[model samples]
Target chain A: MTETLKKFVAGLELDTRMLGMIGALVILWLSFNMFTDGRFITPRNIFNLSVQTASVAVMATGMVFVIVTRHIDLSVGSLLGLIGMLMGTLQVHILPQFLGLEHPLIWVITIVAGVAVGVIVGAAQGWVIGYLAVPSFIVTLGGLLMYRGAAWWVTTGQTVAPLDSNFRLLGGGAEGTLGEGLSWLVGIIATIAAVVMMVLSRRQKNSHGFKLKPLWAEFTLGGIVIALILGFVTVMNSYPLPKGAVRRIYEARGEEIPQFAVMHGIAIPVVIVFVIAIIMTIIARRTRFGRYVFATGGNPEAAELSGINTKLLTVKVFALMGALTAIAAVIASARLGSVGNDLGTLDELRVIAAAVIGGTALAGGIGTIYGALLGALIMQSLQSGMAMVGVDAPLQSIVVGFVLVLAVYLDIAYRRRAGQ
Target chain B: MTHANAAHPLVEMRDIHVSFGGIKAVDHVSIDVYPGEVVGLLGHNGAGKSTLIKVLSGAYKRDAGEIFINGEKVEIHNPRDARAHNIETIYQTLALADNLDAASNLFLGREITNPLGFVNDDAMEAETRKIMGKLNPNFKKFADPVSALSGGQRQSVAIARAVYFDARILIMDEPTAALGPHETQMVADLIKQLKKAGIGIFLISHDIHDVLDLCDRASVMKNGKLVGTVNVDDVTDDDLLSMIILGKKPGEETITS
Candidate 1:
């Protein structure tokens, strides 16, 4: 039976560690659902959880690269706060003076400026850590303090409110959804992409005369993926828009409200997370830059000797981290409909925890984008689950900390036993 | 050796000097390698042999020197520059990215990529299989990271990397130090094969037997300075050892060939 189970897992090409993590997530969700008397597993709660996880999840994907290269970015939270404040000011105070109120370009210009500043700041920190030969810990820790102070200085400790309506859609609230039809369209397209990718990869392997997984296994894996994707779409599509939101949407469109309740399909921020995950996965698995990143992390001396410009690569990785943090800032501040000094405060810890819990080793040279996404989800679930069960915030944090350490410990033990 | 030397030497590191913090690690070392010849660099641990070779391999910049490739004055400021000139080095540490599979390590700097610039890992694996099949037919762990491989297997990965690139000047630093007798013999055969292909090789080894068995010439270093270069046919193991240990050349520096 054990042999058969092993074969089954191998056939499906499933990572046992990932499977274990998925199992833990399922158990956590189910237990929480019971504790909250089924409230925790509802479509509304799950949707909120996904949206809440988006900012950290987005940052976590970049953190995989940062940590896989055996570095840390403790300044991500502060960087996000700074960028968010800067973008907030641009949208409210500056862009209006230049382009008039409610101009279409205000949001676009704000986002581009935020991301640009993010990359510049990130690359600057990277330059110091790379070319200057400073330890990443010391450098980013300084950035943590510096950027936070800078963020406060941006608005002089005042909260920026009443952001542009369009910008707020990125934050994934009642108005930040794709609606039912668009969500199904995205789900269908994603499923088709997944299938095509698998078939193309299989064909490529075949051309090289490499061993292929069994046809049944391929079908089974495909089935599982399709089920998961469609299932998520269905769940999102099931959650009806609140009566007030439905009326507002119709009134804005200058149409009478429909008789049927409209579903608030996938949240926009959640879609952003999915898109980032896909792009980051492709970058990590298929690009030479990604290959070099892993190689440099694996052995700095070997990578340098192999003619890889590792110092420059460090700068690029950190720059990528900065850009991602900017995206997170967009989601975060938009979600709140305002930007404050406390925006993304302590988010560095959450992002790092998400990456570590997702199986990124601190020692470097090993991580996955999907692992981080799932890790973020798991973390959010734990916190919200405890909250639903009426646990105090302090207790929730304590439990979350224990889980993080325990998960890493368990992952280490698992890897040791697996002899990898 | 005379016939091989009749052609222009493939690599010449003239008056190479390197120092660290005022300490001369390699003081005025000059060496030349002819195509299809193996020149063994003999020295004790701190004798500057590795440092001199590192300059040629582009691991270190010379404090003062000139390097010529195929009789052309060349600049080699980095490992990429060295590789651009088809110079490959298998260091004492093997220099394999431990977390990457053998194929990834083999084609690291020069990966086989699609037109889109994405790494074609399958193509690289196929190429690695073809090469490893030739080098070590028993090597089956192409899918696992190099870290998971045994010492000899890891050695083969490093060797495969250097050889696969069609290097004109190959530097092997104690290639067989981690291998068993059988694997050592395998490397010896590989060296002979590489030599027959007209590759110029710099073999750095403390093993007198390895030098005597494989090298056509030997250059010994002591106190960051060259003792002298000698024809392997004219020197016994004792003569080479004395040159390494006592910083003295043998009785006569004659090329009988």
Candidate 2:
């Protein structure tokens, strides 16, 4: 028992970005509730916050990869805008003639088309950056302007609106009378993912003839996370809907009525963001490609000597970032039900800030996908809390900017201390 | 004493010449290293010691000459080819990534992977411990990055990597230039251990004391030309200095040393 206790302490001391992010998130939640007279913890407000943060949070996941490799893609925001515009244009102008499909099929095609555009554009930029050895800053900076201009040219500086009903459902859709079911699903999936990851890593270590972490530590952490997720779902489910709020479905005239509900249990954007975050985290942590990413970031010259094709790795990273930007664009456009030239204006700064604040070094080397997501959440929470207190946009911007600078300073300070 | 004649020389270079642009960096220099023997290459800075080693390690291609390993002539046009011939080089800078641990540095370019294809850290750590035990039993490298290690420990890691890869000919450039007394003694012990293992080592140094202590035969160069090779036991530090300064035999009285 004494040895087990000692092992438990060691496990707690392990260096992990996930635990840090969780700690920060808890602090942010408590502070927001304390300062806003408990208004910030409302079910409606929480759901709204999830939807609002999903777009940028998803974008930052890809941005983490680019930043870790000591490269920047200033073109991400513009790529998002261009992808959104392409989806909108295809749904409005080309879907009818391109295919006779309707509803769900057309929605699927539009999303795929958006993703394709993102991939093509990303590959073009990656080729220049990797093959020509052009500085990523210059290539991506040029891409930022060019892609934004392309978006404007595609739409002629006009907003495309009145998206098909099916497309709208993708952003804010309802599935049945299972209120809070989707949120519960997300919570369960995340907990399961966390548990599976821990088990697989342990197994991998043991198979490779390495020491394994104490079983109790792993189980205790996993159990606590699962319990917390269940508790969150219960709290969210218990909140009573405001009086006269529209029900999602109503039985009338011997037919079902699709009521426009604000909380459709879970926002599609939130689910999309969570799923993407999980996938990216797996890819970055558990694969050979992930090792190459870390190696390239840590020391490019050493990586080259180690026989890693550093150029291919760099270009692939950029391409992956592009794909992520497109996923974010899809979620954004689906939520807004329209796309315009200014869809992703100034979003590049937020994405980069999210990665930096999450502890990804701007100098290239160490980072985690979860860190970027947590960084985005911290930004989102600050923005949402300030808005709840009736703070102006400019003031909120200034506060976030200060937080970003503070996070970077803290990162540098931590590294310096570690160096010593 | 007769072992040097009984066993074939580990490495031999014939009329090795390397030039950059129009100037010859290493002009017609020839040297040989016998198994289990230390050979010192003495020269001033820019006097072609480094250039000659670079050609042997295939870091630089020779404009002319042939290299033989164990009496079999071979072409080493690149570092990979040099490794194929069991020739390893320890450069002045060490070329080690400071952030990596000793084990990672040991198998930097080539790592042991498990069935899952991830780097097998445990296997590597175990192998590192085993190798350190044999090479430098006093080395304590557990969980420490090379950056945090002492200068002697870092050198141990570099030498261990070369030796672990089965290098028959070890080329060390200025191995003890920056070491203190104690650290220098540690490296000297390591050199004796390598000599016992029957591994031929090329010790390049400007310190006459190190050459006299560790080398069996000392070869001096002046202006990219070989002066002569002398058995370390038969020559004095003054004799080696005369060869370097005047490019002549010791006791000719032409150069003051």
Q: What's the chain B TM-score of candidate 1?
A: 0.96
DockQ for the candidates, in order: 0.86, 0.22
Give the Å error, residue A206, model 2. 6.0
| Structural similarity to truth (TM-score) of each candidate | 0.98, 0.80
Give each model's clash number.
Answer: 0, 0
- Candidates in order have lDDT scores of 0.93, 0.78
Give Cα distance to truth, residue A30, candidate 2, Å.
Answer: 3.1
Give Cα distance to truth, residue A321, candidate 2, Å: 2.4
Q: B1-257, model 1: which lDDT tens digit per residue? A: 64344556899999999999998999888999998899999999999999999998889999898999888999999999999999999999999889999999999989999999899999999999999999999999978999899999999999999999889999999998999999999999999999999899999998999999999999999889988999999988999988987787888464221
**Model 2 spans with C-alpha error above 4 angstroms:** A1-11, A16-24, A101-127, A162-193, A196-216, A228-279, A282-285, A418-420, B1-41, B45-91, B133-146, B168-171, B177-202, B216-235, B242-257
First chain TM-score, candidate 1: 0.99
lDDT of 1 by residue, A114-151 (tens): 99999999999999999999999999999999999999
What lDDT score is found at residue B115 in candidate 1? 96
Candidate whose DockQ is highest = 1
lDDT of 2 by residue, A271-335 (tens): 67768887787677545576667667767765554446778887788878888888888878877
